[model samples]
Structures are given as C-alpha cells and as structure tokens.
Target: MFSTVENYWIKGTPKEQLMDCLTAYKKENLLTLAENQLMPMKKSHTKSKIATALAEQLRHNFKITVDQLTETERHILTAYASGNLPEELTEPQQAAQATLVAIGYVYLFKENQQITPIVPKELAEQLLENESEKDTDNWFLTTKTTVETIYGRCELSHLVTAWNQHASQPITMSEAAKFV
Candidate 1:
C-alpha cells in the first residue's frame, strides 16, 4: 500500500494539494466548461478504473491475473500502476511548483549554453590566417566569394577560377589575394 501510494505520489506535490485543485476546478469550471463544450466527451476512465480494467485486459490478453490485491487494493493498485493520481486541490502547492521550477532552471541552463553569440567574420578571418595551406586556401576562396556575392559583384566567378589555378601551383597569400 505504501509502495503504491509512493509511486502514485510522483516525487512532487502532496496528494492533498492535487485533491484541492481538482475540487476547486470542478466547482468553478467556467473556462473548462466552455472548452469542454467544443471537445468531445472523453472516455471518462478514472485512474483506478483504468487500473482495474488493465488487470482484466492482462487476464484476457496474457491469460493471467495476479491474485494478491483485494478490490480496494486493486483500485489503488490500478491507479498507481497507471501512474495516475487525481488533482483534488486548488492552486498548485509551493513544494510542487518548486520542483517544477527547479526542472525549468535546468532546461534554462541548457538553452543559455546553446544560444551562442554569432562569431564576427573578422574573427573567422583571424582564425584562418594562422591555419594550414589547404585551410587557408579554402577560407580565402569561401570568404572572397561570400563577400563578392553579398555585394552583388560578378567578380566572384573570376576569383574562384583564379583560386583553382593557384591551387594547381602554390602561391603566397599576397599573390593569391591580388588574383582574387
């Protein structure tokens, strides 16, 4: 019974808080009523009901049903087994919100790391300057073509042709830069 309750508890809010919210929502129901009017009626299987039904399903499907649990135990077991518990309370309890908030911050930290600032073109240029010959050639060709294309100049084609020729016979950066 303790294991069943603990599993259903979900390591978050107290059962009382959820019960309160469910009770309040059931009473007021102004927004939910309007929304539910548009939505189709759900199958209306409670967690406990579903759990009991699942045991029946297991018996039918697998030809087996465990006999340890009583009717009340079956109801509680079904509810817990389905990993469902009711929100019978009002506004979310502080402890529940705190747990969720902590989870939110973990996600926030990951997002912050992924949101890198755009590296300036000048930085790319500087990085490429000290690289190997092949890297330097690729960088120069890419940078030259990008710059010319963005400026709507027809010189990019000429620059690529010059680069291909220079690759066949090595040339200094100044010499290659002049051709491009």
Candidate 2:
C-alpha cells in the first residue's frame, strides 16, 4: 500500500490523519523520530500503536510537544498558524521545513510539479487554536483606549503593529528593533 500523505490517509479527524501519516512511516524511521527529537515515549511495538499513543498524548499537550522543536521550526509553525507565511519558502524557510519533516511535525507532499509543505492537520488545528486564545483584539482595544486618553485620538496603525510584534513573539529589545 503505497500512497502519498495528502491522499486518502483517511479523511477523518486531524488526529486520525496524523496517526495515519505516522503509521505510513517505516518502523525504523518512526523509531528514530521518537527517540531522536519529536517525542519521549515508552518503548512500544507496532506502527499504529505508537502513532495512536503519540497522537492522543499530543492532543492535550501540544505546547509542550512543540517545545521539542527548534526555535526556527517553532517560528515557521507559528508563522503558518498565524496565516502570515509566504506561499513560497526562502532558503532558510526550506531548511526549517526540512527540520520539521525530520521531527515529524511536517511532511513534503509532491503533486503536479509542486512540492508543498504540509503540517499535519492535527498540529495545525492545535497551533491555530492556541494562537486564537491570545485575546489579541481585547488587548489591543485596551491599549488603544489608554493611548487615546493620553494622546487625544492619534492614528494607531503603527501602535497596532508594535503591539502585534511584541505580543506575537518573545523577542529581545534588539530583535524587536529589527522588525521596526
């Protein structure tokens, strides 16, 4: 049974699909992935067993799971989650994506002459859900009100951008300056 990841992999819940993709991996590869980077789990046999176990565990602890990835990989995943990443990746983006694949958070799917980076739907859902939990609009509104009280109704697009930069990432002062 040979099939690409984006294909059948059972159009089910994100977790189910992720389990399918992990199951598709050869046993050796899955073993390497589990041991080397993506997760820490009890020893196990059988493809479906390991995948199912990891998926269930990951669903509740996605933030912890993501912490296992590198900073660039986490940034790429977050960028994707926030709907801000470009469709075409740059060199560094490609390298980060390759690392994601190796860590089992992403897959490269080729079809019709294009290679697309595919984060497991399960992981994407979790990441986007976490991002939405930020209550960003409420925070922005509070900041906007405070600024208007002090400055008497100035434009705030720049302020909004500043808030977004500070809120979306945990960057140092210098790194924040670079974005500006």
C-alpha-based local distance difference test score of model 2: 0.61
Any idea what lDDT model 1 has?
A: 0.33
Candidate 1 residue 42 C-alpha distance from true site, Å: 92
lDDT over C-alpha atoms for residue 170 of model 2 = 41
The CA lDDT of each predicted structure is 0.33, 0.61
Candidate 2 ranges beyond 4 A from true positions? 1-16, 37-44, 65-71, 79-87, 135-180
Clashing residue pairs in all predictions, respectively, total 12, 0
Tell me the spans in candidate 1 whose CA falls farther than 4 Å from its real position.
1-131, 154-173
Which TM-score value belongs to model 2?
Answer: 0.57
Instruction: Put down candidate 2 lDDT per residue, 32-111, tens digits, no spaces.
Output: 66764546655567777677766565556667768677777788987765546577777877677666665567655444
